[model samples]
Every structure is written in C-alpha cells, then in structure tokens.
Target chain A: MAVTLSQDGRFHRQLIFINGLLPMVLMGFDAWRGKLGVNPAEFVTRATGVMTLVFLVLTLLVTPLRKLLGWNWLLKQRRLLGLFAFFYCCGHLLTYLAFDRDWQLGTVFEDVVKRRFIAVGMFSFALMVPLAVTSTNAMIKKLGGARWAQLHRLTYYITIGGVLHYYMIVKSDATYPLWFAAVVVVLLGYRVVVSLRKARERVAVGVER
Target chain B: MNPISKIPSSEITPEETFLNRRFFMKTAIWAGSAVATGGMYRAFSPRSDVKSTGSEIATVVDSTFQSSLGADEKVNSFGEIAGYNNYYEFSTDKSAVAAKAKDFVTDPWSVEVGGLVGKPRVFGLEDLLKMESEERVYRFRCVEGWSMVIPWVGFPLAKLLSLVEPRSEATHVAFETYYDLKQMPDAGSAGIDLPYVEGLRMDEAMHPLTLLATGLYGKTLPNQNGAPIRLVVPWKYGFKSIKSVVKITLTNREPPTTWSLANPGEYGFYSNVNPKVDHPRWSQAKERRIGEAGSRETLMFNGYEAQVAHLYAGMNFEEDF
Candidate 1:
C-alpha cells in the first residue's frame, strides 16, 4: 500500500514535542514538591531511564508501524522521538552525576568500569550521540540517505543495551525490563516479517514479468 | 480585602518570637500538669506522629536504658523512617511496604528459639518484651547503598542468647522472618526463597551491639518496619537485620540466607557493611543517607569496626563479604 504524508505533519510534530516535554515538566514539579517520595534521587534516575527507554522503543516502533499499518505520517515524528530519547538519556545521566554521585567524575568512571549495568548504560547513551547529532535534515542530506539510515540503525542496538542495563540494575524483579524486552522483540519480529513479505512480493513481480 | 492590613504592624508578633512562644507554652504546660507524668507531651509532639501510617505505639518506657548518639547523627523523622522500608516479604517498592503491611497482624507472635541451644522454646512477643530493653540510635546502612540513623528500642542479643544457653557446638545463629502467604501477599511472588532467612557467626550474633529490637523511636515496631520483634545488627547491611522474625536457630554450619540462596555470589552470608567491598551491581564505598541531600562515605562494619573488626581478623574481607 502506498501512503502519502499528511499536510498536518506540522501539527503532529508540535503535539509530539509538547507530549515529550510534559513528563519533564511533571517530574520537575514532583521534585519541587517533595512528592518523589523517600529516595528522590533514585526515583528521578529510574524515571528518566525508563522514559528514555520508552521513547527509544516508540522511535523503533515507527518504522514497523509505517510499513505494517500504512501510517507514513508516523515517520515524520521519528526524529522527534529519537531526540526525546536522547534528552531523557541525558537527564538520567545528569541526575546520577549531579545528585547521586555529586559530580564525582572519578567515582562515576570507577562505576562505569566496575559495574556491568553502568557500563552498558553508558555505552547505550554513547551510541545515541551520533544519531542525535545527525537527526537534522541537513546532516541527512550531507551524509546521504543510505549512510544516514545505516548509522541510525544503531538505535536497535541502543534499545537492546538500554533494556539490558535496566534488567541487570534491578535487584531482583525483572518484570518491567522483561516486558520492555518483549516489546522490542515483537517490534523487531514485525520488521523481519515485513521484509520477508516484501522479498516474496518482489519474486512474484519478477515471475510475472 | 487584604488580611494583613487588618493587623497593626506593632501588634503582629515576629515569626521567631511566635515560634519561641509556642515552644515555651508547650514546655510550660508539659511541666506544670499531671499530664507530664503520663508523657503526654511526647505523644502530642509535632514530630511524634507526623505522617504516621497508623502503627500502634507501645507505652512501655525503659527509663534506665540509654545509649550515646553519633556525633552529628540526627534521628530521621519518624514518618520518613517508617515510610521507607524494603521488606520484600511484603513488597519490593520501598514506599509501598508501609501501606501494604498495614493489615498485617503481628500480635500473638511467638518466636521459636531452637537448634544448638540447651533447651528449645517458643516465647510470645510480650514475654520477650519483659526482658530488659534499651534505646540505641545507630547508623543503618543498606546493601542498596542507602543509609539511615534509627533510634531502636530493644535489648542486646547477648542477653537473650544467655537465657537460651547455646551449646558449645553452636557456631552460627540463623534467623527466619515470619512468612504467611495470607498475611504477606507478596511472599509467594517476591522470588526469594520464603520465610526470609539470615545468619551470623556465633561471635557476630553474640556481639554487644547485636539487638533484638521490639520498638523504634519510643514506639512499637511498625508492621512495615518489622513488627512484634526483629533483629537489629547495625554493623551489617539492613537486610541482615531480619524483620518480623519468627525463628532463631543455633547451628554448627553456616545456614543459608535468603539473598545468598537466591544469588550466592552477589549476597554473601556475612553481608557486613564494608565500604571496601563492592556488590557486583553497585559500589559500597558511599551511601545516600535517607532524608539527606548527598552521599557519605560508607563506614567499615558501618562504623562499628572497633567492635567488629576482630571478628573477621585474618580472614579475607572480599571472600567474607
């Protein structure tokens, strides 16, 4: 099915931007009001990390949804979602650095080296940097679409790494992270199925010709 | 329309003077009346039950029991201390434990003290409380890298062990937390092997600082904070202080602990609070004190090193951890 990009793309983009900012604003308000509960630092850190993963998963869902559901308008919002994921990833790291670690670079460095979850989390955030930097139209045009798409493919690995980081960090319960992992697997599975179908369709077209 | 304009500037009391006057009045009332004998002021103090979660406060006072406080340690507000807990038998979420444990019935509680003791016996909660109890404010450190200073009311474990009369063969003491599927809804789903168990070497169990806490902050232990009776081993991580204890067994071998049984490598049986020893998932060098802004350096044996260091003498700290 051929899907046309809707003229309401700008409106959708604005809505996405506001939606992305809403959690940040709410978290700030909660922090100000002592509503984050006993360990605000841990609460904020986990919240931002979860938000980052949520946005990353949503960003990944865009491609499969566009192909499977014929929702081409969803493609336009992918960059915003990816940027929001990066924003929250930064928030998660900053919360850990400023509040939890008190900006002790040495301690953080030690943790990144010693703790498996911290190391994986740091790696996932580092992977997002290039994709975030090249999210612009100019960068896409400069790098060409094929190369840009290949580079952005790091998102899949980032998502996996983020989920692993979360799964490993939790003391015992892995229910939430396992659920996130299941979602990623389903989304990735959809992509594989769509590609197989496309391959089969191409063979049918060749045979008809 | 302005309320402030109705009161003349001279007639208005300064905020400092107003607060001081209120404190003065409260002190005067507390000192001058028969209510003073009943400790009415303590019951009605602003800090007593602020944000309390409806846990009963025991009226028993151990007037003779007193202990020194740490130099700069401040008692975490009753609400904050009680509001936050990690009783996994009840729930995993720290803040959820209090509410979830509200319906838990801890009375008619009996502790079976057995194994290597000369005589195995079960004692009711009231019977245990009949023993001498004292108040000690100690720094509590959790394996999750959080800390709190708690004012615990209890007697030393040594005194209890003396009554039980452990046999010469006793090498370790193991404690089991009460686990009723009906009362603790999460017990079936907490993933840990149930009837949460913890252990200490014979010497560690007999340490002077080891307490069988019955209350906290001059109140009966909240269900969430381990009601009826619980162990309070301040030098070790908080989990070592098993909550809602039911059985204490003296054994010749190291008994399996809940966390250790779940993940032996991550949680050792001797889970003492040591800054030098780090958990595989996180650092133990520093801990975020609950209600405090920033992390502080975690102490060796949680600052009871002078008392506990000899227990681990000549042993590899990493292996013991």
Candidate 2:
C-alpha cells in the first residue's frame, strides 16, 4: 500500500497526542481527589510504571502494526508513543523519589544498591534519557539517521529491563508481567520474520538479475 | 361552627390529647427515651471501656478482659486499617480488597477444628464470639516491608486450643482460609494455592500473645480486614496471620503455608519479623509504616523480642526466616 499524507493522517496524529495526555490528566485528578486508593504513593508508583510499560509496548507495536496491517499512518504515532513512555517513566521515578523516599537521596541510593529490582529499574530509566533527548527531528538529523536508529535500538533493552523489574517486584502472580513479556516476544518475532523475508527477496532479485 | 359544636368537645380533641390520655403510655415513652439516651451516653462515655462501633462484622467487646498500649504505640485509624489490606484471596491490590471483599458472606461461618485433637469440634461465628476477647494494640509487620500498629480485639489462641484438647502427638497447628470461587474471584486467579493455609509450632500456637482477632479499633472487622475472625501473630510477618479462617488442624508435621508454598525460598514457614533476616526480593531491615512518609528501622520480632525471642532461642534466624 502507498503511504500518503491525508486529512485522516493529521487527525490520527492529534488523536495519538490526546490519548497520551489523557492518562496523565486522569492520574493528576485521581491524586487530587484522594482517589489513588489505600497506599497513594504505591498506587501512583505502580500506575505510572505500568503506564510506562504499556506505552513502551505500544511504541514497539507501531512498526509491526504498519507492516502487518498496512496502517502507514501508524509510523507518525510512534514518536508520540515513545515520548509518552518516557514521560510516564519519569513520573514513575518521581513518585518513587518524592512520595516513597521523601527526597531522601541517601536512602534512595542505598535502595538502588541494595534492591536488585530498583537498581534495574533505575538503569532502564537512565538509558531512556538519551533516546528521549535525541527523539526530535533536529537531533535525529544532527546525529544522522543511521547513528540515530542505532542509538534508539536501546529501547529493546529498556523494555526488557522494565518487564524484568516489574516481574521481580511483584510478590506473586506474574500474570501481567508475563503477558507483557509475551507481547514483547511477539513484536520482536515479527521484526525478525519481516527482516528474513526482505533478505530472501533481495537474494531472489539478485539471482534473477 | 354549628356542626362542630354539636359534637362532644372531649371526644373531638386533637390526636395529641389522645396521646397524653394514659399515664402508662406517657411513662413508656419516657422510659424508651431514657434507654435510648442512656445507650448513647454509654457508647460515647469516656468511662465506658468497651467501645463497640456499628460495623458489618458484628463484634462484641468483652468488658472483663484488659489490654494496655505502649507509650510510643499509636492505633492506626480504623479507615487506614480497614482500607489498606493484602487479602490475596480477594485481590492482590491493597485498595481493591475493601471493595472486592464486600461480596464475601462472613455470617453463618463455621471453622472445623480437627486432626490430632482428642475432642475436635466445629465452632460457628457465635461460638467463637462466646469465648472471652480483649482489645490489644499490636504492631503489624507485613513481609512486603510495610508496618502498622493495629488495635485488635480478640482472645488468645491458646484458650481456644485448650478447649479442643490437642493430642499428645500434636506438634503444630495449621490454619486454612475460606475459599469459594463464586465469592472470591481472585481465589482462583491470584496464582496462589486455593484456601490459603498457615501454621505455627505447638509452642507458638499456645503463646499468650497469639490472638485470633475478630475486630479492630473496637469495630467489627471490615471484610477486607478479615471479617468474622482471623489470626494476629504480632511477632510474625502479617501473612502468617491468616484471614477469614475456615479450618485449623493440629498435626505432628509442619503445615504448608500459602506464601511458603508459592515460593519456599522467598517465604519461610516461621516468617517472624526479624530485621536481621531479609526476604529474597527485598530487605526487611527497614519498613515503611503505613500513613507515614519515610521508613523506620524494623525491630527484631517486631519489638516483641523479650516475649518471643526465647521461643526461637536455638534456631538459626537466617535459615528459619
């Protein structure tokens, strides 16, 4: 299918942005209304963490979705999804630091060292910083598309790390994290299949020539 | 006016006049008001020690039993105690439990006390209530690294065990929580073995501090806080205090607990609140007290060392944990 810039494409882009901002606004409202449930700190922290993983998974889905369903407009939403993932991750970290730790840097540092899940979660968040910074078109052009794509590949590791962190933190019932893992596997598998098919096509063309 | 005058004035009096006709009726109303006022006065009176608030769980405070609180201890608000819980049989999310557990029917509940006991018996909710119960303020420590000071209203486990008459071979007391897939949606889905089971050594079961709580903060337990009855082993991690218990078996061998069965390495059978011992996933040295901003240093045996330390005197703390 041929990709085209149409009115529908512009509308979809706006929808994606609205979808990303909706949760942030709802979370703020929930927090304000004291509706964050029993443990507000933990509720916010887990909510943001789950949101981050959700957006990360959604961001990973864009390429496969476009390829499989021929929804070319999905490519435009990928950056929006990635940025939303980063935004929620930052919220997750802030909830931990401000509400959970009460800005006690020493305790937070000790936790990062002592707790394996926290350590992994922090590391994953740190890796996201550069990707988020270079997500802009200007920075992408500055770094060159080849190098930018290579740097952005860190998302795979970050997603894996986020899932692992989630899996480790739960006391029991790994259902949600397991589902996330399955999704990640499927997305990555799609990418592998597509690349293999493209390689086969290139070889076939070369042989025909 | 002429028609009204034709009627007898005494008979045509207002309804208020009829209400005041009999002295007995007047006295009855006065007595009823006095009783209502007296009941309210007693409920709110500072001198009235037993303060039973209206709640769904139906708790009755025993006035004879006595309990005192430590200087530093503070009772967590009933809202906090009831609102925040980890009744995984209902749900894993702490907040979801309160609402989800509303579907649970705690009335008409009975617990079967059997196995290795000479006189095994099935005790109904009322039968359990008949036993002497007291209000005790205790520090509750969860294995998830959170702590709360809860005012529990119940009797010692030893009193109930003694009535059952455990056999000479009985070395441990095992507990099982209620399980009904129709009622507890998460019971089938939480990935834990159904009918959550917990146990304590015979000595621990007979300990004076081990209470079977039915109420908190002078109110009947909220469904989320384990309505009808539950265990309250203050020195042990919160999971050790099984909730909505349906069965208790006295056995020679150790009983498998829910968490220990789920992950043996992470959760041990004892599950005593020891700062020196850490859960495989997280540290137990410090704990965030619910309703507090920052964490506090966890105490050995949750500050009941003097009472429970001798129980585990020879055992290795790290291994047993």
Best by lDDT: 1
Listed per model, the TM-scores of chain A against the true chain A are: 0.91, 0.90
Q: How far is candidate 2 from the true structure (C-alpha RMSD, Å)?
A: 19.2
- CA lDDT of B293 in candidate 2? 63
- List per-prediction Cα lDDT, in the order shown: 0.83, 0.81
lDDT (10s digit) by residue, model 1, range B69-162: 4666678878778877899878877877887888899888999999999978899877887876778788889899998899888888888888
Q: Estimate each model's TM-score.
A: 0.85, 0.83
Query: What lDDT, from 0 to 1, does candidate 2 have?
Result: 0.81
Those runs of model 1 whose alpha carbons end farther than 4 Å from true positions after fitting are A1-7, A200-209, B1-50, B53-69
- Report clash pairs, candidate 2: none
Candidate 2 lDDT over B167-256, as tens digits, reads: 999999999998888898787779788788999999999999999998877667778888889999999999999999899999999999
Q: Write the per-residue lDDT of candidate 2 for residues A58-144, one digit (tens) a residue.
A: 989888877778877788778888999999999999988886566877898888887899999999999999999999999989999
**What ranges in model 2 sit over 4 Å off?**
A1-15, A99-114, B1-73
Report, for all candidates in order, the number of backbone clashes. Answer: 0, 0
Q: Give the lDDT of residue A155 in candidate 1.
A: 93
